[model samples]
Target chain A: MRPRVALNIKSVDYEFLQEQFGSKSELLLKSNPVHKKIPVLLHNGKPICESSIIVEYIDEVWSSSPSILPSDPHNRALARFWAAYLDEKVPLFWVITAASEEEKNAAVDQLKEVAVEMEGAYGETSRGGDFFGGDKIGVVDIAFGSMLGSARAIQVRVGVKLLDEEKTPGLVKWAEKFSADPAVKDVLPETEKLVEFAKLLSAKFKAAAASDPLRR
Target chain B: MRPRVALNIKSVDYEFLQEQFGSKSELLLKSNPVHKKIPVLLHNGKPICESSIIVEYIDEVWSSSPSILPSDPHNRALARFWAAYLDEKVPLFWVITAASEEEKNAAVDQLKEVAVEMEGAYGETSRGGDFFGGDKIGVVDIAFGSMLGSARAIQVRVGVKLLDEEKTPGLVKWAEKFSADPAVKDVLPETEKLVEFAKLLSAKFKAAAASDPLRR
Candidate 1:
């Protein structure tokens, strides 16, 4: 059996709360008062913040069934490399969506650079198999796959499309394969729900930025 | 025999590199071309960039000796929490050292807040243990312990100490115990060397900031 770990998972859903601040979850606030962010997994009442680190903890705790990381060290490191890259780079998508026209264009250019790096990292010729590490889905897939919902929404909101089969053919295939996986598919929010949430969040950020001129 | 996973380790004497930039080794550049930073580990020619991630990879690959992480899930998560906390919070020291008088005072205030939080997290009153977990050294120690070298240097450079025994008795005792460990002590850099290097880096950053008006 998986260890009895308490996970205070949060999202931009409001049925559980009054408003969708995305950071209003009481459990999250108690655990990680410093960052006050979501996806804080508390094991034995002690909190481990950061989503990627939490996933790593989960993988270590429950080593049976589907292993999130690979057995080989090199392969595992590669998986981790991609995960870190995604965490460090993918936030630009939201920035692009929320930016002014000039800033938005600059962010789009940065996005293309990141996309090109991803393309190079996971090229058709290199990752010729199903997933990022080939054969099975691992942490890299989970890390990048989790962001795809937001990525799609950001693309739609910003009027800039990325991750096309023609443009990023390998990444497109990988995203499709990742979504189809039973385990991954189980946790993903619906695309429509996520898009609506993104729109709301964008409006909120824009409004806040307008009111607080220092934000720009 | 350990598996022949490609490994590149470094003793990053940042102080030494400041005086003699030639001492800034090529491994940092080779391992992380994109970030161009240090504490990178290259596994099978692919770079795992972040220091914490590198430590985890090292522990996973070389599991024979001392286990950097705890076996229990709860303890492991707790270890990871402090490690992430150190990474997120400890950078304030550099900021304080480099800031103007007003900014330095603000950073000092922020540092005090973090110190209180850290004391609460791993203090004698809260954890009631020797190390971050209990009894033995673990990943939290490694993650935070590595910073002790820099912490000591920063304390000397800034002329303000934050890790005194009386103020944070638990953390102080923990740091003392951690520094005494053979594994940690063997790898740590000399305090004098580190202080010298910190001075050089401070000057470099100041010069760069002066030249670049956009630097914040």
Candidate 2:
């Protein structure tokens, strides 16, 4: 979703491959032998794995309008920092489905704390605008925006509000604006479908955790 | 160490502050409010946290001879990919200190396979040269090179060879070459000192693991 949104924002036409989860593909294994994960961008014949790296690679190669990353070095570093911070909280999106009550409570608290910081970041970077990039979606926007779908799914599945008006009013608005954006509207998965997928994944994780506690 | 080595390679003279481990100061807390960890590069007045991000920031800000990262887009992507890969394996460095025997064996096996892939990566990136940046220590070199001190300490403390001549001949040679490079020799810690630190860390981690299983 990150690379796709990045490609869309860059106006680069590309095919999307819905890789079958739990089964490795020859092409994927060949392209990204290290991680063997999705969000692999095959440009010309070379593969660029990892979503954030692929986004930066796309920005460099396309060199089109609406540059995904900022031009200033300090801005780029802040963007990278926020992107890393958001990506690090990815498990926070799933811990609701995979954690114990104690862990779930802890994750929720941490996520709320993350939301407070991110709200300030969005406020500062937006400069009273609608997005983290002040106007169009930039790296920091795409970074957390890509996870908004999963976050919504988790919110529904867990019957918990991770981002609400009181906690993250700006983020709630940002999420709505981000999902409605023309470039990435089709890219973000529907919340209901993701909810069902989350249900299945939670079950799968529960089974895996039966034997391997670390799966949680 | 990554940013320091890159700064040295870029010929950017700077003061070094030895941050006391365990107890983060107010400056660190103010600079990097997110992680509040070490390796925070204070440039002018702003702070850049995370070693890898700091290295790229230095490369972008300094922009002199001996480029830390490559110029080409694909090559730059490859460098970032390898850097991310090596950083992801950071846990493989500490698992030996706080892991079960079976888990440690699994980590060892995984590290060996990582060595195989990294050897191929080094061979391709170096192109018959000494460092991953071909002639000088670039991003990839600094990425893994900075970890050589701990790896050597682990090799001695754990009695397990990670990058041996039989499995990774090029890497063994590259390790020596990277360590001997004047730009980063002082930045890399002494193995004996690191070995002692590793022992103390292992003991501390064991104490933590006694209460929390995830400490390992």
Candidate 3:
């Protein structure tokens, strides 16, 4: 979905292939033999794994579009820094759903803290503009925006508000702006749908754990 | 050390500020507020953290040097993929020194597997050239090359060889070639010195654990 948003933002045509839960295709395994995960963008038959890397590749290949990363080198570094930070926090989202209640609360707190820092990052990068990329959705926006579905579903499932208006007004507003963007609106999965999907996923995990307690 | 190697390769003279083992400097804290870690490159007072990001930043800012990333977009994506893979494997190095004996053996086995995969990566990316960047070291070379000192020291301290000549001949050869490069030879620490440093670090970890068993 993240790469699709990037492709849409770049105005490039692509074929969307969805991988089913609890199973992977031979194509995915062959394409991404390292991680064998999703969001692997196949361009000219070469696979680019990792959402941010694929987004950067999209930006580089489709140079005619507005740049995803900033023009200045330092600003680009900051953009990449924020993108990496978002990626680093990915495991927290998992812990929120799968761990003990204390661990879930801790993950929530950490994510809230991350949202605050990202609020500052949005302020610094946006320069009073509407989005993290400053008036247009850039790499950082896409990176964080990709996770909003899970964040929203986590809110619904875990009863925790991560990006609160009072605490991180900038991020809250940016999340709204990013979600409503035409390039991503259609690509971003619906919150309720994601909630259903998350339920199915958690059930699968429980089943797997019942079969093999040492699944991890 | 990784950033310094890139700076040297780029022929960009810069000042190096060493951070102490236990305490971070005010500047280091301010520069990299998020990670508060070392190898933050301060250029014109703007800080760029993370070794790979800093190397890419150096490449972008200092455009005249032999390109750190490949010119082709696909190759660049591949380079980034391999670099990210290397970065992801970083924590296992810590497990080598800090974890239990069984865990250390598992880490060694995992690292050896990683070396085999990286050998395949080197074969694909090098394109019959001497380095991962095809004769002139690029980002992947610097990424893995930066970790060579620790890998060599691990081989000495842990009684295991990760990048074995038979199992991962390409990576083993690449390691030697990368270490001998003029830009990185002086920057790479000696294996014996790194082994001693690792011993001290392990001892410190043990002392810290003794003081507080709950510390993660």
For lDDT, the strongest prediction is 3
Query: Can you give the lDDT of residue A188 in candidate 3?
Result: 86
Which candidate's DockQ is highest? Answer: 2
lDDT of 3 by residue, B112-152 (tens): 88898888888877888999858898988888887888898
Better of 2 and 3 by DockQ: 2
Alpha carbon deviation, residue A194, candidate 3 (Å): 2.0
Better of 1 and 2 by DockQ: 2
Clashing pairs in 2: none
Which portions of model 1 miss their true places by more than 4 Å? A1-19, A41-48, A90-94, A97-106, A124-126, A165-167, A185-187, A190-216, B1-28, B41-49, B124-129, B203-216
Better of 1 and 3 by lDDT: 3
* lDDT string, candidate 1, A71-172, tens digits: 887667767777787776655666554657766666667666676677777763235677777666666766777777777776667766667766787788
Candidate 3 lDDT for residue A85: 86
- Pull out the clashing pairs in model 3: none
DockQ per model, Cα: 0.32, 0.57, 0.52
Question: How much lDDT does each candidate structure score?
Answer: 0.63, 0.83, 0.84
Q: How much DockQ does model 3 earn?
A: 0.52
lDDT of 1 by residue, B1-216 (tens): 011111212222222122136355566777676667665655556666667677777777767655667777666766676777777665566655465776566666666666667677675323556776666666666666776777687677767676776677777878888777645555567989878777766776767656632232
Candidate 2 lDDT over A64-168, as tens digits, reads 778988888888888899998887788776766766777677777777888889998998899877889688899998888887887778678767777889979
